[model samples]
Target: MCLLDKKAFVDFITTLWNIWNYRNNAIFRGKEEDARVIWERARKLNDDFRIHNFSIWSILPWAPKTCKWDVIKLNVDASMKANRTSLGIIARDLDGFVLSGKAIFINRVVNSESAELDAFLEGIWLAQSLNLDKVIFETNYACIINHFCKHKDDITIFGYHIKKARKMLDSCSKVDIKWVDRGCNKVDYSLCNWSLSNCYNLSVEMDYPSDIHNLVISNVI
Candidate 1:
């Protein structure tokens, strides 16, 4: 068949050996073989080997960093409960100092994707209201980031909000929209969770409420 890199070739050979062993067991030893289980085992084996030997994760661990000297980093998240959705955003400067943060409650029911996009839109507005000239908007939802990356003339249902966000972003001197894993977005998650229960459309001070102290510290540290 096709040639592969050294690591891929080794993995391929190992998977083939495992499959051949499975076939032998099924035919001669009368053992049952599950395709799903075999494939999962092969993947797990490959991943574990790479993790231990290659140490890839050790090089690029998930730690959200501060923005550039002139840019503010905004983390936004949405949490849905029954029919209502809570949107949260936290803005921090290059020194990890809080700039502005908000927790808003939307009174209507919306799908998770829409909720995420709505939260993102709120973040853009929040940045604009604070007169932030440079921004790096970060979200945990990869799909929403992809939505922003699409063409400006997109005709999808969420295109309106995306277009508005892009327009607001254009006003900024520098703007970046990026996706981070959930682990790196805890501050936004905490803000959304708090908003769902306590703060309904409230603007938070730099020294946020006592409840969010740990979360803010964790992110800054």
Candidate 2:
């Protein structure tokens, strides 16, 4: 377990325990469990234990400040309905001013975690489109972040998407990806709602739509 910190080691062992327990139940109690279910259960157990034992989340990094003039804090969000998923991204400056935004609707089916990862890739692409070098991408979802940051390599189907995001980030000069509390992501969530409701994709660099743009500074996180 080279450099597999406390949290990763805990989750890894929890997963093994879950797999063993699932195997026993399947044999004795005739409870058939899928691989996905076992993994999720292990993750839940790990999270619960972490909360009770170490309160690890209290030390999690929040949305970083865009202290420099060129640095931008980009909040990315995703919402899925049926098979269609909407991706929303909004960038703000140090003074909480809107810089760039995107709302993309993709007609495909993917798990919620995978779709959130898709929004993350979209955020990177959005940054590239704006030719940004210093940017901080914030998301409420933690799966992809933990996958890379915590060195969690799992058998989930979304692993490919995570790899894609990794290669995309390598070209950047300064990049930060972190998990922000859901309450702090209301603006992007609203942008996600708008995109899904209209089934439209939008990219704006300046003078963003009056409705969603107004939600940023008012609900600064």
Candidate 3:
């Protein structure tokens, strides 16, 4: 077995046990109030138990602190149809050592042109809200990126989204939009799948998917 600190192992087991018990009582037994009480009691017990041996191990840090680079990765993908299309956006802070925040936006509308525009506008709004300065916007659609960079003004159907994106771009100090292979954009694809599965609602600052999380961890290390 892999060696682990005895105290740390015990603490992990205890926390897991407490979580299981709370879930069992609340969800399985339908005793939500009692479960809440038990959860509070467990929290207090854990806190009291650690009072004597206070150590950094007891603290659970969700995001690592060593990450110095903050890069925003924005992606857009669309599913085309004869008369309609579906669009998706995945905007995330891809940090080297920290757990990044994610935002997913999706919509279904008539035509791929409109869908691309919507995705672009949504990405801009997300970047602005997160105060992202160094953005690396990516998409599987090379044509869209090329058009945006070349300042193509003839895309009337997506003109508004393009205009808004341009305005947002002007506000940012540094921005780079690029095209990546579809196989390399799994996180963006997952966000699209998730959006389609959830009926096109908005998910902001959601948990990263397992595959994406694993990829990020492996890369960071």
Candidate 4:
């Protein structure tokens, strides 16, 4: 399912559902089942379901739009489970070209907000490492954005990290922190999930994980 669009994901699920229903009908109601026809029906149902349930806005691609010409955008996300937090980050230029991406695994337990803060710090460090002084950072966690907005650097154990991140931002020529919906940050979300699954802790420059390529294509298109 790598690089699957939303419609493709929905199609995959609906096909499975259709197969199940067809099997049940054949067993209980003596219906003749044809695989090809069933697949076509499933595809039609998926399209109809999307049309009926989703607005135009919802059907559009989930990736964020490109940033301003002179700005680079970084999307960061994290997945926490048990005693570990997996982080993902991707920096893209205004043309939606990936400058760098990272997948990280933090072997410690933390609350969701703290995990998000760590991911934010990772993004800042990444920007600094790349000498990218003008950046727009995005995340799905609104609370994380609000922490910086209110300067709440003394409320949690990770507060010190937040403060350091702020200092890094100060050194940047320009920086903007924004809260975006999960859908618009799918690349980083997928990277987080990948890191969690594989325990990866490395960064890629001028390259991307294969699974992210399709979604990246959709964004640039």
Best by lDDT: 4
TM-score of 3: 0.53
The clash count of every prediction, one per candidate, is: 0, 0, 0, 0
Give me candidate 2's TM-score against the actual structure: 0.62
Which residue pairs in model 2 clash with each other? none
- Report the Cα RMSD per candidate: 19.5, 21.5, 13.7, 17.2
| Residue ranges of candidate 3 with Cα displaced over 4 Å | 1-69, 80-86, 93-108, 152-161, 200-206, 209-221
Ten residues in a row with the worst lDDT in model 1?
Answer: 59-68
lDDT value, candidate 2, whole model? 0.79
Q: Give the winner by TM-score: 1 or 2.
A: 1
- Taking all chains together, each candidate's TM-score versus the true structure is 0.64, 0.62, 0.53, 0.62
Decide which is better by TM-score, 1 or 4.
1
**Which residue runs does candidate 4 get wrong by more than 4 Å?**
1-69, 152-160, 219-221
Candidate 2 per-residue lDDT, tens place, 1-221, comes to 97899879888889999999998999999999789999989988876686566545644445533433577888998998867888888888867778888888787766888778778888888777666778888898887677757444655657766766777878668888888998878878887877787888877666877776578757864
lDDT of 3 by residue, 1-221 (tens): 14768766665676678877777888988866555666677667766777555565556444523323367677666654333345556665664332233334334355566666666676777677666667777777766776677665545645545656787778667788888887656655555655566545445345765666775455445
**Residue 111 miss distance in model 4 (angstroms):** 1.3
User: Backbone clash tally for model 1?
Assistant: 0
Per-residue lDDT tens digits of candidate 4, residues 1-221?
A: 87999878888989999999999999999997789999999988977777567565555455533323468999999888767789889899988888888989887767888778778888988887776768999998987777677666477645566666888788667888898888878878777777777776867777666667776777667
The lDDT for every candidate, in the order shown, is 0.79, 0.79, 0.61, 0.80
